[model samples]
Target: MKQNLDLAPVGNCSVSALIDRCGRYVWACAPRVDGDPVFSALMDGDDPEHGFWEVCLADLKDVEQAYIKNTPVLRTVLTDTNGSAVEIIDFAPRHHKHHRTYRPVAFGRIIRPISGAPRICVRLRPSADWGARRAEATSGSNHIRYHCTDLTLRLTTDCPVSHILEERTFRLETPLAFFLGPDEGYDQEVGPGVAATLDRTVVYWKDWVRTLYIPLDFQDAVIRAAITLKLCAYEETGAIVAAMTTSVPEFPESGRNWDYRFCWIRDAYYTVRALNRLGAVDILENYLVYLRNLVDNSAGGHIQPVYGVGLEADLSERIVDSVEGYRGMKPVRVGNQAHEHLQHDVYGQIVLPLVQSFYDQRLIRPGSVEDFCALEAVGDRAYALHDQPDAGLWEFRTIARVHTYSSVMCWAACDRLAKAADALGLADRAEVWSQRADTIRARVEAEAYIPEEGRFGASFGGRELDASLLQLVDLGFLDPMDPRQVATFNAIERDLKKGPYLFRYVEPDDFGEPETAFNFCTFWFIEALHLNGRTAEAREIFEQMLSRRTHAGLLSEDIALGTDELWGNYPQTYSLVGIINCAVLLSRSWTDVR
Candidate 1:
């Protein structure tokens, strides 16, 4: 049953869980949550066709992917050349809502066959530690265990086959086949009834998804991304991974690779908002608990910008040379070293969603108010160290710089804190925070803005344009029509645009050398343009971004300016959220489009 065996296929290293279509098998490494990877080497590897056990993708000619409502179940329909088609559904359980899915995955389950009658096959060959962890195939049963002290995974295939791909260090995915003739044959063969387990899995997602209140339009994309994000999230801890794979090059042929399996405070905040907006308080609240634990666990001195998916903020990253990277970029990395940077504004970023919880949803109770009080206490520390230089948003490896964007977000922190405090009737403290907010805002305006360039630079004493400044217009730091906002937008258009890809800033960031043009920054540019009354331009920019989705309706973190190959991880939920949110911002505006 040799169907589609990719011997040497490219893997997505940018974000985890992105399926390299050229490679075929989906790659994911999580449960680390902090960017410390559990899986590695996704781009392209030595053995093109890979797998200890093959995951048979229902022979698909017409493959359409989507999520099931509000849950994170990824559904794809595959039609074979024989016109026999099946819908393959994938979703690593989001946070355990009703205590159903145990063992919250650093890297976990991939459920298949939701609704279809195609001969289905699955080949699962998990390359642990980016293919470094040794494996001991359990005799008899079709299960293999990757030997690791911190990491444990058991993979089973539903099909009997020659598991040749798993024998050597290879790239791409190994092959497997499913013959769908009649009567759940695969189901009867496996004990405990595979059909029943699959059914329960589907029910698990369905019931969980039903708990959320979806939007009127763009509901599908939102729920899908939201759910996908949750699936990537470790259940007990609300840490959502940046992606699943490691060392997917941000720029093709350039050694600009990074792993995003860890959970970021920033991304968690976005998850909060998306959940809050979608009317689900559980995940958001659980994430708050995760943060509380994270803060409690590592609350001593300085806070890292991100944490492992399991809530460990400490991650030391190094390169693995056992396999070549996607398209020949070597030395794919496993852990993230961003744990040792001074990202003061990260507290503010984390606090934003908490602020939203306080102001917008009111789901936060009185004890939550106490939580704010403690968080505000930390704000005092930030105020004391605000003027000092530190790593900016990108968390660069070099010496910290006076990143204006960090300062700007720091201002936002105070701004949100003041408002939240005021709402909670702590007006006196609010006033003090408000005064500090004014100071930060004044510093951002005075120091970050380059009047000569007619835009804001990445840092104080620097004169390069940044995409973050575009948020000034959206976040209302500056009115969309203000001279400064206009100037910043123009400068971003001039300097930051790399074809369709846009950089967060023109200057080099801390995540290693900036290579691929960032995709979400482009979304921010569109949001700025739309908010600034340039509706058509925003629409055009948005269209360009939409056109960049892979053969799958997914996006990567960045895009190569030349090959247009998605740089970074595949199926980035943040990028999709950007596209969905921005599209909604444009299409269904409450205000008139200028």
Candidate 2:
């Protein structure tokens, strides 16, 4: 199998693997998503042992892959030219055990011959030290232990161990099960254990999908996006990562590769909003605890834009010199430096999700006066720093500016808090916050808009156009019908539009011109069009965007406007959020469809 971006991800919320269309495991991380790479072929280019696990047929002719209905369990069928075929069922074990979610650090594969005399070979290669060293293996009758410097994985299999050890091709005779996990003995029965795990995992995912409030149109897209977003969440800590893989690059040799395994408060906020629109509250409920921990840890001081999934604070960025990058792109990075940048918009983002807990009675712990007080502390920061120069939402490392988007977000923070305070019957706090919101809004309108150009700029007293200006109406700083906003939208279309997609901005940043269109910004443009009474055009562009997704119905962080190829990290949560948001906005209402 060759390296491809059209891979499907299978995960249990703790760990995940990206399997190519040919049933080869291209990327997987052990222990956690940000942990050491156990299977790193996705980044290592052209190595003989490319740290992959593949079940290859000797005389393969065709391959087909799809999920098992609405579940995350993937099934791939490989057929030889001579009417012989085999089925590979791939999934991570996820089910309930002893009333607790049983998601171990393991990957499960079940191979069953579906047609006549299919011959196959199982190739399992894992690596350590960032793919610089191959793992050593020692086998027994029904198990093989692979030593990977810091950790070891015990592969418990029911196939002939000799065949796997020597990579010999053999005729398909019976079903085989393989479970690669931490060094531990297998359950009582290998076949039954795996079969039961698959059965229960299918049931678990399908049952969860049944609770969604899907739109009348684009139901399939919405469901797939929701499932992908769920897969990105680290359920144990309720921290949702921005994407699955790291350093996939935003462009070809653009050197914009980044590690998105950690949770960004801004990205998580958007993710929760999309899930909430689908009537999925479990994610929001789980994530509240993470926010609470961050608030408590802040000690009423500064807040970082990103953090480890386990709530660890420090994230020092560094490149792995030994490992080759994706498709031979260099400088594969591990950690993110955004954690140290001063992104004041996070104060507003932090409060947006936290405020939802106050009105939603379905949460385990509804917000109280104490909760409001804690939120006020965060809002205070937004109020004080709304005019300060920070990295902005773009995280421009070389320069800092007073971003208009950040100020509007601060206004939204105060505005939402005022509403929540009024709901809780705290009239004084509501009035105070409402006044502050008005003050911030006036400052934004005064400093961020250029009357000569009839458009709002990216920063205060500037004329450069950016895609984020489309969000002013969404933030409630301006009414959708306001002509000023219309001018801003039109100006953005004139300056930043690239065919069907939109550039984040037109000006040169630290890395010169951006190489591709940001996926989420295009979705935001669609929403802006819909809000501005251009529903027909919005629906048309929305369909066009949907058509660009991978065969598995997934989008990466960036898309090449010229070729429409997905770049950047795989299965980006922000892109998935765009799918849900656009589907909900453009789809016909359930009332009409029913």
Q: What's each prediction's TM-score?
A: 0.80, 0.98
Error of 1 at 283 (Å): 2.7
User: Any idea how many clashes model 2 has?
Assistant: 0
- Encode model 1's per-residue lDDT on 501-533: one tens digit a residue: 678766645444576778888888788778778
Candidate 1 lands at a TM-score of 0.80
All-Cα superposition RMSD per candidate: 6.5, 1.2
Best-fitting candidate, scored by lDDT: 2
* lDDT values, one for every candidate: 0.59, 0.90
